[model samples]
Target: MSLLTALGVEKRPSCNVSTTAVLVESQGCRSKDLVNITACSGACSTYTLYSAKMKALEHSCSCCQEVVTSERQIQLTCKDNTEITYTYIHIDTCGCLEVDCSPFAHSETTNTPSRMRSRRRRR
Candidate 1:
């Protein structure tokens, strides 16, 4: 089973769910590495919209004063006023709030030379 399924959390298409508000309110029980935020709709809003690709820096929930990391989950408000709650899994030992892509295998063409060149040319 997938990680989400194993964790008993339903997997959504883009991590956009209604549970974000509830999670935000219960910050005390949340992990220090996780993140949670809200999205404001309408015009003249002062809060910044959340970006899925953006890495967490030093923002902390009002309820909890712990440092946010990539290993925790986050809630972000989108441009359309939608709230997205997703978990961020860290792949590297670095403490930076960034996505690590080193675990994935490199492309075959990029990692290895063409094997066809050693074969005899077609008559």
Candidate 2:
């Protein structure tokens, strides 16, 4: 019954979190410990398509973003041997969500060459 999934035709990239090592520094001070940073990444669906019913272009956009974040503080060793606190956002969760693609929104479009010409003329 499932043609897409059972046939392995569904091959969309999933949004998820990725990890990397980063050096944290502040005010000439750097963290003495190795810091691991996690970030939201990957491709979410984004498209611009022509709609026959509306006689216009439609754009749908979603992005991988942090759904939940936590504030974290770290101590950095300064040149004077004093410890300084630095705050950063730690990504707790990530998901795909709709983002603002255009000022015209979903119902309206701004991609056609004719429309672009009209806009330039008005300006």
Candidate 3:
């Protein structure tokens, strides 16, 4: 039984193996137990599967020109056609992933603590 079917999802003819692979990994399915696929049927090794996921993320981030913000996020469609959400922190923390952060980096904010301290000194 395919992972989706095993999990009670109806098997659709249009769904591709790549989508299934991403869904399986993202769903936390164990790599060792690809459950339904036959052995030696060109199954992607766990390393390769995850590597592809990483590359897909990098490519998606590369194409993103939108402003990065905590409230602004991007959805990535994996080669398997499965979708995943990524936030600014998600892409920013991955130093290798390039994104424009100038807006957030240069935004001005008042120092509330210092302002409070000045008020206390005035009293």
Candidate 4:
């Protein structure tokens, strides 16, 4: 199943030329899972799908100068026992496309913790 369908998102009529923006969250280096999809036409309407885990999120869409601006925020938990929260903004202009993907670590930072103190002191 398409990630959107897995997320329980209602599919909308495809634009003649449509750009898709997806944000995913997963555990550790594993394939990221699609958590949301936001599609828009340059006109004045946008479509959004929310997963069962994200029922209380908020989204907004606005159109200006043949550009569709869609902003969405969602919080998701992955099967790997990790939680990720993300916000994405998609701008579709003149049938052009732009996509941005960012992944974050869910664990506490140990990059410079005291466990390395002895090594640093010896240096």
Candidate 5:
């Protein structure tokens, strides 16, 4: 088993289930590192949005032009005494949010024609 599997942890790719939401995961250790846990716990001062307009929240993330809709903070204490925290952010994208994992994946995409073909064939 890999280190993550042995530790009861696994990393999955980011996914967007709708036009205004995305799911992502991250893991870190508390004994050797505290920053990751703190950030995931919402202790970090990241981009926050209080506006209803999607365009206004586009600058929340420096790496991409994503509009923030909501945030969920989670904290956990692992069996190994490691404190882990996870922050899940739901954002809006112009198109499909790609694997670059940043404003790349999208629930409602307008540019990819293959997306329509795939959906139609599934029926």
Candidate 6:
């Protein structure tokens, strides 16, 4: 057992859910009357150490992710006094999941980003 663990040191969870108010703005419209957003926002364990089994360095990591999510729609008031509907993923539950730390496995997105899809409708 590790010294810290054997000494009775408390260990926090690697990842968990957190709630915060995030102002969402898009296409000159903003959401100021929205409720707080809940999402996975915790630090994950990452370390590198020497491994005797392989006689080399070893790396381990975990990342906070949304284990459960649901689609949610919100109305944003625009500057023109008009409103638009935006749909987004609401994180219902979150946890730490093992992930590949290789940059090749993870794609870096640039320029063309479509995070939130909004649609205007006629009433």
TM-score, each model? 0.18, 0.68, 0.17, 0.26, 0.21, 0.60
- Which tens-of-lDDT digit does each residue in 1-123 have in candidate 1? 953356453332221112132433232333324333332122111112233567522221111111222465566555555656656543222111222323224665554355445667798
For model 3 the local lDDT of residue 123 reads 38
Most accurate candidate by TM-score = 2
State the TM-score for model 4. 0.26
Model 3 misses residue 121 by how many Å?
Answer: 62
Runs with alpha carbons beyond 4 Å of true place in candidate 1: 1-70, 91-123
Index of the highest-lDDT prediction: 2
Ranking by lDDT: 2, 6, 4, 5, 1, 3
**Residue-by-residue lDDT tens digits, candidate 3, 42-105:** 2111111113545632211121122322333445456556677644221111112233322233
Per-residue lDDT of model 4, residues 4-112, tens digit only: 5675544442333245545464343222555444444444333354546867333434332324566766666667666666666644443323332222234466454
Which consecutive 10 residues in model 6 have the weakest lDDT in total? Answer: 103-112
**lDDT of the candidates, in the order given:** 0.34, 0.79, 0.30, 0.46, 0.38, 0.74
When 1 and 5 are scored with lDDT, the better candidate is 5
Compose the digit string of candidate 2's lDDT tens values, residues 97-123.
888786453345757555666434553
Off by over 4 Å in 4: 1-23, 26-66, 79-82, 92-123
lDDT of 2 at 43: 80
Extract clashing residue pairs from model 4. none
Model 4, position 69: C-alpha lDDT score = 61
- Whose TM-score is higher: candidate 2's or candidate 6's? 2
How much is 88 displaced in model 5, in angstroms? 3.0
**lDDT-better candidate, 5 vs 6:** 6
